[model samples]
Each structure stands twice: as structure tokens, then as C-alpha cells.
Target: MKNSDSGARAGALEVREEQDPLLHRLMPSPDPAARFFWMSGADGRLRIEQCDACEYLVHPPSGHCPRCGGDRCTPRPVSGRGTIHSYTVNYQQWFVGQPPYIIVIIDLDEQAGLRLTSNLLDCAPDDVFVGMRVSVRFLARHGVWYPVFVPSQAMESDSA
Candidate 1:
């Protein structure tokens, strides 16, 4: 509501692999409607679309509001705090040289039933739990910001 998304850069994570060719090929390009969600990483914030009519928040950025059929959806910044609704430790090598990682469905604190699928970082795969507290972190590559999550305990320590 306050446009607070841009000013706070503390604890911001930058991956710095802008030249990684593999990432360039792996990450999908954001179209015009979803640009805010992907590009907000430039300022270290996470934004999702909110409906102007019914105030319903939606992800994947549909041009029209899914609930109200309103065309006035706008991107709004979120707190980026959530709980791990579910998760999996992927042991198979989806790509060569890639280590096992935990993928999670985060239930964002913003609204009920609002979830985001993201990779869990900075924690051991075996240590993850279904209700772990996580906060959003950004992985910047080739001008696209990918949202990842880390244990909220680590985030608190980093800030101190």
C-alpha cells in the first residue's frame, strides 16, 4: 500500500550469475502481464496481482480478475513471509551436475489458499519440514528474478 517494495534492500540476495548460459535457457521469459512479479527482484521485493474490484489476490498474473471478472488487476508487493505447505527433496538429476534440492509449496501469509511453488535454499534437504517458516529470497540472472525461499531462522540471524 505504501510502495514500500523498492526502498528496503537489506538482506537482499543477489546470485550474480548473469552470464550463466544454462540459467538463461532454463528460466522462462515473463510476458507483459506478469512482468511485475519477475522484475520486482530488481528492487528486492515480491509482488503479486490484486484485483481492484473484489480485492482478491491472484498469482500468474491473469489480465482479468478470476473472481470478479474485473480487468483492473494490479501488482502489489507482499511481505514475502510464508510457511512451507508441502515439499519434496528431488534426488534425481534433472540436469547434469545439479545437486539434490527441496522444492516447496509455500502458503503465503498474505491470503488463504495463496501459494507459490519455489525452491528451498540454504538448508539441508533432510532438515526440511512441512510447516517450516520461510521468507522469499531472489535469484537474479539475466535480468529475471527468480523467487526462492530460505529458513526464516536464518533470515533473522542474517539481519542481526
Candidate 2:
């Protein structure tokens, strides 16, 4: 199947092997605090750290709450909606396929300072801009799933 917006093929064959050798080497084993964040994607949910005491949301999964130094943080589902806080287009041949791709820092809607760094798929690298709305889509590789963002439906319609 072809993606209507990006013209890229989609569905079951979309997930490819890690084409960047350095990225493959740098993929870390999920620590206890981050295990849920990693595994929840396989279950089709975006989970982040939520502090039980202060109600602060944390990304990158921390053992203690950065706000109140509380140890009562747990994984909670987030809306998976965000805005592109920042991004860059890479022109180097780091991965397979083409030379240019977009990497974005998403500021998740759940809380301030809750952000994730992920690739933006289903759009041209040059099309990405700060403050662009996006939503998460999961891709599996090597038995692990990751949450990547794509242009939100609103953004798609605006472009159309």
C-alpha cells in the first residue's frame, strides 16, 4: 500500500532493518525505568512517566520525579499528539534509502518539558517546520516497536 500523503509504501512491509550501523550499535537496552516506555509501543500505546505526587509528566523515563524529587512515578498513557519544537534535515548517507530525512524534537501535549526525539515519516524532509502538529505511529524493528511521528490529519488537510 502507498501512503497517500508521502507516496511511500506502507503497511506490513514498511518496517525495515536498521540501515544506520551506528544507530544499531547505539540502541541501548531498556533500563527498568524505561522498560515500560519501550514495551508499551508494542501494545499500541504511548506511555510516559507520570509523577503520582506532583502530576508531572516526564519523558525519557526517570527514576525520580524531576519536579518534586518524588519516587512515585509510573508509566501512563499519553495522547501521542504534539508539536514539532525543533527539527533538522540530515543530508548525509547515514541510513539506507535517500540522503535526506527529518529528525524532530516533539513537545508532547501532555505536559511542558515532556518531549521525545524521533524521526518524522510520511512527509518530505523540507516540509517539516517548528510548531507543526503531529501524531505518533509505531514501527517495529528487531522485535521492538518505536513511536515515530507523522503529520497530523489537520496538517494534511491544510496542505491539501
Candidate 3:
């Protein structure tokens, strides 16, 4: 089959090598930030960028902090707790096995203006809405455990 993403960034992603149940990876990104992000996913954890200088948590990496012009940074594990700020169901998809999926923008807990985009699975796409509670789940794909979100199971059971 033809490749879906042929961009440079996609080329750099870890492609899965199937040997058994565990992922066999090659040349994982050595940058601490990237390694930290991927490592967390492997462990089913979620992380956001932490500004080392000012203690501000940033969602997207920047050359300098907007809050405090400090350059130092680290990847810190987040609570995996968030609210769905916005979302969309992609009825027509260009990627395989990903059609009819929901893409969500999540606002993380505890860090002001901290948010990220990810897929929402194991839920009815039409049911997702703004301000919905969500939590992270890692889906192992192409030798990586990508961080995806779904409605919190705990919240659902509690509401029952």
C-alpha cells in the first residue's frame, strides 16, 4: 500500500518492526524532549512541556517562553486529565483504519493555556461535545504508543 504521510516529519517517526508483542524500534529520537514525550507514551503516560526557567507549562515548544523569556525546558508527565475544548468527526479520512474518527483539542489540567490535539477512540464520535471530560489512552502504532484521549471511564461510572 502507498504511504499516507510522506513528509519529512513522518519519515522521522519510528516505524514498527514486528517480532512479538513488544515493539522493536530503531533510531528513536535522541533529543531529550522528544525521547521524554515518546517514553511517556510507551508507559501509557501523558506529558506536556515544562519551562525550566519560569515553571510555566507550555503545550507547543517555543524558542523562548512567552510568560518568561527563559530557554530551559523539560518534559513533565501531565495528569492525563482534561476537558474537550473542541472536536470534529472526520467522516472522510485519508489514512487507513482512521476513518470516522474524532479529532479533539484538549485543555489539560493544572497548567494554564496548556492544550494539545489527539484522537478520541472507544466512544461514539457523534456523542463527543465541548466541555466533555477526557483522559489519555496510548495506542501502540508503527512502533509508537501514540497518546489518544477518550471520555474518562471513571467519570462515566461515577455518573451512572
**Which candidate should be chosen as best, given lDDT against the real structure?**
1
RMSD in Å for model 1: 4.4
lDDT of 3 by residue, 63-152 (tens): 457789788887776677789988988776454443476888989876756888877765787789899888665655555566667676
Q: Compared to the true structure, candidate 3 yields what TM-score?
A: 0.70
For all candidates in order, the CA lDDT equals: 0.77, 0.70, 0.62
Write the residue-wise lDDT of candidate 2 on 48-95 in tens digits: 888899989887787688889999898887777789999998788755
Of the two candidates 1 and 3, the one with more favorable TM-score, higher being better, is: 1
Rank by TM-score, descending?
Answer: 1, 2, 3
TM-score of 1: 0.85
Per candidate, the number of residue pairs that clash is 0, 0, 0
Task: Give the better candidate number (1 or 2) by lDDT.
Answer: 1
Assess candidate 1 and give its lDDT.
Answer: 0.77
Q: C-alpha displacement of 155 in model 1, angstroms?
A: 0.8
Task: State the weakest 10-residue window (summed lDDT) of model 3.
Answer: 6-15
| TM-score of every model versus the real structure | 0.85, 0.78, 0.70
Cα displacement (Å) at residue 112, model 1:
0.3
Q: Over the stretch 66-122, how does candidate 1's per-residue lDDT look in tens digits?
A: 788999998988878899999988787766866677889999988998999988887
